[model samples]
Target: MSVRTIAVKYGVHRGTIPTFVLRSGGKLRSTGLNNERRASAAILYRDGHTLQEVADRLGIDPKTVRNAVVAEGISPRPRGRRPMAI
Candidate 1:
C-alpha cells in the first residue's frame, strides 16, 4: 500500500512517522564502573551469559566485553572519552 493507506490504517500522520523512525542521535556513552564492570563481565562470561548479553548489561560493546574475556588479566574500562583539560 501507499503512504496514505499506511498512515490511515495505523492512525498516524505519515510525515510525522518518518521523522520518528529515522533520527540519528550521535554516539551513546555508557557510564559504569571499570573494575566492577570488567570483573562482572568476566564472571558473567564464566557463568554462561553470552558476550552480547554482558555487553548490554554493562553498557559496553560486545567486542569490548569479548576483549576483556580474551585478555584474561586485563579489564574493561568505562565507556567514555577522556576530557580535555584546556
Candidate 2:
C-alpha cells in the first residue's frame, strides 16, 4: 500500500509512514534526496557544465556540487587559472 493511502486511511501524517514502516521492519523504497541531487549534479557536470554553472542551475553552492561530483566517484576539475595558448 502507498504511504498516501495509509496516511488517508489512518489519519497519520504521510511523512511519518516511512518511519513507521521501518520500525516495523518493512523496507521503504525510494531514492534519497541527497542521492537524487548528487545524480543531477553529476549529470550536469558530465554534460560539460562547470561546477559553478551546475550549482547556479541547481541553486546550490559550487562547493556542494564539487562534493557531490566527488562522492559519485567522479574526479573534480582542477581549480585556479586556466592555461592560455601561446
Candidate 3:
C-alpha cells in the first residue's frame, strides 16, 4: 500500500508516516504498534518494574523495552550492571 493510502486509512496526515524499518530486510514495524507498546511499557515501568522484568511480562526483548522507554522520553534505570566510578 502507498503511504497516502495508509495515512487515509489510519486518519492521519500523509506526511506523518514513518520512513524507517527496524532492520533492512525485516518487515516495516507499525508506528501504531510502537506507540501502543511504548505506552504499555511506560505505564508498567512507572509502576515500578525493572526493564528485564518488564520485557518478560510483555514478551518482548529488553532492547525493545529500552527503546520504548526511550521513545517515550523516559530514562529507564540501567539494567544488569552499574558503571564503575572513575
Q: Each model's TM-score?
A: 0.43, 0.53, 0.52
The list of candidate 2 runs beyond 4 A from truth reads 1-33, 80-86
lDDT of 1 by residue, 1-86 (tens): 54567689899998855555456643333333476666787888766577777888888888888777766664444444222345
Clashing residue pairs in candidate 1 (N, C-alpha, C atoms within 3 angstroms): none
Q: Best candidate per TM-score, number?
A: 2
Pairs in clash, predicted candidate 3: none
Global lDDT of model 3: 0.72
Which of candidates 2 and 3 is the stronger one according to TM-score?
A: 2
User: Which regions in candidate 1 have their CA more than 4 angstroms from the true location?
Assistant: 1-33, 73-86
lDDT of 1: 0.66
Q: Write the per-residue lDDT of candidate 3 for residues 1-86, one digit (tens) a residue.
A: 76778889989887666542224443654532367778999778766777788899998887888788887888866565433545
Could you say which candidate leads in lDDT?
A: 2
Better candidate by lDDT, 1 or 2:
2
Model 2's number of clashes is: 0
Ranking by lDDT: 2, 3, 1
Model 2, residue 24: what's the lDDT?
98
Q: How much is the lDDT of residue 28 in candidate 1?
A: 30
